[model samples]
Target chain A: MNVLFQILFTISILTNGDIKVPNSGFQPGDKASDFDLKSVDGKNYSLASFKDAKGFIVVFTCNSCPFAVMYEDRIVELSKKYGKKGYQVIAINPNDPEVKPDDSYEKMKVRAKDKGFDFPYLFDDGQKVYPAYGATKTPHVFLLDKNHIVKYIGAIDDNAEDASQVEEKYLENAIAALDKGKEPVPAVTKAIGCSIKVKSK
Target chain B: MKVFTAIISLVFILSASKAQTQVLPEYDTYDSLSAAVFRNNDTTYVINFWATWCAPCVKELPYFEAFNKKYKEQKFKVVLVSLDFKRQIKSHLLPFITKNKIASEVVIMNDKKYDTWLPKVDASWSGSIPATYLVQGDKKLFAEREFANLEELEDFIFSFSKYK
Candidate 1:
C-alpha cells in the first residue's frame, strides 16, 4: 500500500491524472526543463539566460495563429509590465517551420521586429522542447519560479477576443504569486487556442 | 413608389431567411472516443464536435439542429458534443443549448484526462473543434477540422446513404 501511494504521488506530480493536456504540457510544481533554441535575433536562449529574474514566463506561441496574433501585443505588454520587476518573459515558437511556412526563421524575425517584441522569440525547430514543457497550443504558457520550477501553465488571460471582458489572467496571477513566494492560487487552467502544428511523419 | 417598396420588402425577406440558415457546428473537444453510440445505429451518425466559444461552431449550430429536426425521421441523427470544460456545462454550455433550442442530445465531456481517452478514438486528432465524422456500417468518414456549410455535411450524408 505504501508503494502504491508513493507511485500515485509521483504520477500526480509528473502527469496530472485529469488527462486534459497530453503528457506534453508543463504542470504545476514540476521542474521547468531547459533547452537551447534559437531566438529570433539569431542567438540561442535557454532558461539559464534569464538567471537574474525572480520568476519567468515561457509562452508557446507562433506567427500565424489568430489567437496568438491577438495576444501578441499583450504578451509584449506583460513583459514590459513585469520585466523591470525581475520577471522575464520568453516567447517560444514550437510549431514546425516546415509544416508552417510562416513560422520559419526569417518570418519569425520579421514578425518579432515588426511587432517590436521586447522579449526573445525562440525557435522550436524539430519541436522537441514544447513536449518537455507539456504545451499543447500556439499560445500555451508556462510560468516558472526563480528556481526554474513551473508555477503555472495555461492561458495568458480568459478572454482572447474581448480584452474589455477579461475575467482572469492566469499567467499574471501566477507571476504575482511566485514573486511573493506564495503558491499560485490556481496552478492550472484550461489551455485554449490553436494546437501546435508539428512536422508530419 | 409601390413597386420599389415591394422590391425592397422581397430583398429584405430573402436576406432575413438566409440569415436564419443553420450551420453544422464543429469543435475540438480535446478528446473523442469512437463512440459505442456508433454501434446502435444502422443509419449514419453525423457527429459534429463544437464548442460555444467557437464562432463558426455557434453559427453552424442551428443548421445542425434543423437538419436533425428535418431528417431524424429518416436514417439520420445529429449529435452536438460540446468540448467546453465541464465547468462551463452549467454556465455557458447549457444556456447556449437552451438559447439555441438545440433538439439533438447534448453532452458535455466531463473527462479531463484527454490524451489517454482521445487517442483511444484516433491518435492523429490534434484536438481542434469543429471536427466531424460520419459512419455507416463498415464505411468510415473522418473530417479532421471544420466544415464550410450544411451542403458539405449533407453531401457526405446523402452520398453515404446511397452507398450504404
Candidate 2:
C-alpha cells in the first residue's frame, strides 16, 4: 500500500500542474539575475539602468488585481520615501496579457497614468523574468541590495486591505536594514495575492 | 381587491425571505480556522484558500462545488477558506457568493498575519490564493494553484484519500 501510494503521489506531481515544486525561485541571500524589460513610459529598464541607485524594490504587480490595486498608493509612497534614499522601485507586471487582458501593456500604461506612478511599471513580455525570479503572485515583492542579492521576498506589508492600519512594513524595514549594512530580520514573509496569470499549456 | 393585495404581499415576503436565506460566511481567526480543518476524523477534508477578488480562484470554484456535490454521500468535505478582506465581506464577498450560489462550506479567514498563519497551513505555501490542502488523518497534500477541471480536482483528492 505504501509503495502504491508513493507511486500515485509521484504521478500526481508529474501530471498536476497545480502541485508546486519546492523552491522554484530566488530565496533570501540568493543573487538575482537582472533583466531588461519595457516600462509603460516607453523606456527600457534593467538593473544596470539605475546607476546611481543603492538597491531595487522589484515588485511583481499588475493593474487588475485588487490586492495589487490596494497597494498601488503604498507602492508609490515607497518609491517617494525611498527613491531619494537611493532605493529604486521597479514594478513589473508579470501576468500574461493573453491570460489576463487587463494586465496587458496598454492597460498598464493607463493604470500608471491614472495612479501617477512615479516608478517604472514594466511589462515582463513573454513572462520570462517572474519565473526566473520564482515570483508566484502579483504584489509579490523582492527587495534587492546594490549587489542584486535578494534581501526580502514577500508582501509589501502586513495589511493589504487598509494601509492606515498597517503595523509592520516588511519591505521598508528590509530596505532600512540593508541601508544600515545589516541583514533584514525576518527576511522572508508571505501575503495573499492573485497568482501570476500564465497561458495554460 | 383585498385578495389581490394579500397575494402580492405574500410574494414580496417570500422573495425577501429568500434573499435573507443567503448564507453569510462566518469570520474565523487563523487558529479557529486551522482547528476546523485539522480535525481528527475519518472524513477527508479539502480546504481551499481563496477569495472573490482572485480571478483564478473564482474561476476554479465551480470544480470544487461540483466535486463536493458529486461526493456528497462519501467521507469527504470541501471547506472554502476565503481570504477576502473582512471589510469587503458584505460589499463584495457575500454578494459574489450569493450571485454564484456557491454551495461549498465557505468561511472567511479574517487573519492578516500571513507570516504566522501561512506556514502553519503549509511551509511551502508562498501565501497565494487558489491554493488547496487535502487532509485525511496523517496524510496531506498541498497544491498551490488552481484545478483546471472537476476531473483534475477529483484526481488530486483521490491521489491522497483513495476516495472514488
Candidate 3:
C-alpha cells in the first residue's frame, strides 16, 4: 500500500507539477525572467537596469492589434501614472515583424514617437521574452514585484471598449494592492486580443 | 426637373448597393453561443471562432466554408462565429462576408468578456483566434490552434462525426 501511494504521488507530481505547455512559460507566483531586448529609443533594456524600481508593469502589445491600439493611451497613462509611484511600465512588442509587417522595428519607433510613450517600448527580437512569460495575446500584462516575482498577469481592465464604462480596472487594482503590500485579488485574468504571431516554421 | 432626376439616381444607387448586400450576421452572447453549439442533439456542431483581423483565421475560412457545404449533407452544422467589434458589423464584416461569398452561417460575437466565456467554450482555449470547438451529445473537443489545411480540419470533424 505504501509503495502504491508513493508511485501515484510521483506520477501526479510529474504530470501536474512540471507539465510543459508550449508558449506558456510562466504562471502566477513564478519568478519573472530577465531579458535584454532593444528599445525603440536606440538602447538596450533589462529588468536589472532599474535599480530603484519597486516593480514593473510589463505589457506585451503590438502596433497592429486593434485591441492593443485601443488600449495604447491607457497603457501610456498607466506607465506615467505609476512611474512616480515606483512601478515602471516596460512595454514589449512580441510579434514577429515577418508575420506582422506593421509590428516591425521601424514602425515601432514611429509609433513610439507618435504616441509619445513615457516608457520603454522594447522589441522582443527573435520573439523570446513573451513566450517565456507565457503571454499569448497582444495587450497582455504581467506585473512583477521588486524581487522579480510575478504578482499579476492579465488584462488592463474589464471593459476593452469604452474605457469610461470600465468598472474593474484589473491592472490598476493590482498595482494599488501591491502598493499597500497586499496581494492582488484576482492575480490572473484572461486577456482578449490578437494572438502573438510566431515565426512560421 | 433637376431635383427629380437627382432623386431617381440616388434611389438607383441605393438599390444597386442593396443587391450585393447579404443578411448581416446575428450577434450572440456567451450563453446564446454555447446554447447554439451544444444543442444536446446527436448532430455534431463544428464551431469556429474567428475575426476579420486575424490572418490565419481568414486564411482557413475557405476550408471551413467547404467543410460546411460538405457537412450540410450530413449530420453536422458549421457555425463561423465572428469576434469582430459590434460597430464594424456594417462597415467591415458585412462587406467582407458578402465579398467572400461565405456559405456558412456567420454570427457576430461582440461579447468582450473573454475571461468569462472562454472557459465556457473550451477550458483549454487561451483566448486565441482560429480556435474550433466540436460538440455532439456528451462529447466535446476543442482545438486552440489553427488548422494547417482543409484535410486537418476535415480529420477533426470526421473523428467527431464518425460515431455520431
Candidate 4:
C-alpha cells in the first residue's frame, strides 16, 4: 500500500507537474476582488456599488445545503443588523445548479422570497467568483474591510446545527471588532457543510 | 399464479429479514474513530466519509461494499464513516444501512467542529463528504471526491494492495 501511494504520488507529480488545485490561495488580510453579479432583485451588484459601505460580508451560500438552510435566518438577521453599520451581506450561490437542481437560479429566487432575504442573493453563474475566493463549502464567509481587504474567512458561527446553542458568533464578533476599529478575533473557523457543487469533469 | 405469488412474497420476506440482521452502528467522535481505524498500522484502511442525506455518498456506497466483500481474504478493511446527524440515526441512517445491507463496518462520526478534525484527517480535505482515505502504514492517500464506479474503486484498492 505504501508503495502504491508512493507510486501514485510520484506519478501525479510526474504527470500533472503540480499536486495542488491552483485557485485556493486566498487568505485573510488579502484584498478581495470585486464581482459584478446579478442579484435576485434583477439588479447587478458589485463591491463598488455600495458607496457608503464600510465593508462587506461576502457569503458563499446556496439553497440546497443543509448548513446553508440552517443559517439562512441568521444571515438575513446579520444583514439587517449590520447593514445600518455599513457592512452589507452579499449572499452568493456558488453551486452549479445543473448538479444540484434545488440550487438553480429559479430555486434561489424562490428560497430568497420564502426566507424574505433582505440582502442581495447572487448566483455565481459561471462559478468564477468562488474559486477565486477559495470558498469550499456553503455558508463559507469572507468578511472584507472597507478597502476590500479580507478580514475574516470561515463559518457563520461555531455552530450550524442549532443557532441557540451557538457559543461563538464568529461573524457578529468580526463585524463588532471591525466596527470598533480592530481586527477580527479568530478570523478563521471550520464547520461541517455540503461542498459547493461543481460541474463534473 | 397464486402459488407463484406466494413464493415471491416468501423470498422477499427472507431477504428482508436477512437485510435487517446486521448490527447497528455506534456513534464515535473523530478522535476515537481515527484511533480505532489506525490502531493496527499493518492493516490497510479504506475509510469512506459519507452521509445518508448526501445523494452522491449513497450512490458510491455500493462500490465500497463490493470492494469490502471482494477482498475479505486480504488484510484490507473498509470502514464507512457516516456524517449523518445523531438525531436522525434511528429514523434514517440505520434503516438506510440495513436496507442496503452494507458489508463494511459503519460508524457515525459525531464531531461537529469541522475545522479541528478536517485538517487532522487530511490537510488538503476541504470538508467534503463522499471523500475517501486510503491508509497503509506511513502512506495515506486522500481523495476529496466521489468514485465514478466500482471499477475505479477496485483499481484504487488494487493499486495500493499490490505491493503488499
Q: Please name the candidate that would achieve the greatest lDDT relative to the true structure.
A: 2
lDDT of 1 by residue, B1-164 (tens): 99999999999999998865543333334333444356655787787777776555676777787778778878776777677654455678767766767789665554444433444444434444566667777665655555456776677667657522
TM-scores for candidates 1 onward, in order:
0.62, 0.88, 0.87, 0.84
Better of 2 and 4 by lDDT: 2
Record all residue pairs in model 4 with backbone atoms less than 3 Å apart, i.e. clashing: none
Candidates sorted by lDDT, best first = 2, 3, 4, 1
- Report the Cα RMSD per candidate: 9.9, 6.2, 5.0, 8.0
Residue-level lDDT for A68 in candidate 2: 91
Q: What value does DockQ give for candidate 2? A: 0.47
Q: What interface RMSD does every candidate have?
A: 8.2, 2.7, 3.7, 2.6
Q: Which pairs clash inside model 2?
A: none
Which ranges of candidate 2 are over 4 A from the true structure? Answer: A1-21, B1-25
User: Which ranges of candidate 3 are over 4 A from the true structure?
Assistant: A1-23, B1-28
What does the lDDT come to for candidate 3?
Answer: 0.85
Model 2, position B95: C-alpha lDDT score: 90
* Candidate that would win on TM-score: 2
Could you report the DockQ of all the candidates, in the order they appear? 0.11, 0.47, 0.38, 0.33
B-chain TM-score for every candidate = 0.70, 0.83, 0.83, 0.80
Candidate 1 residues lying further than 4 Å off, grouped into runs, are A1-25, B1-164
Candidate 4 Cα deviation (angstroms), residue A170? 2.0
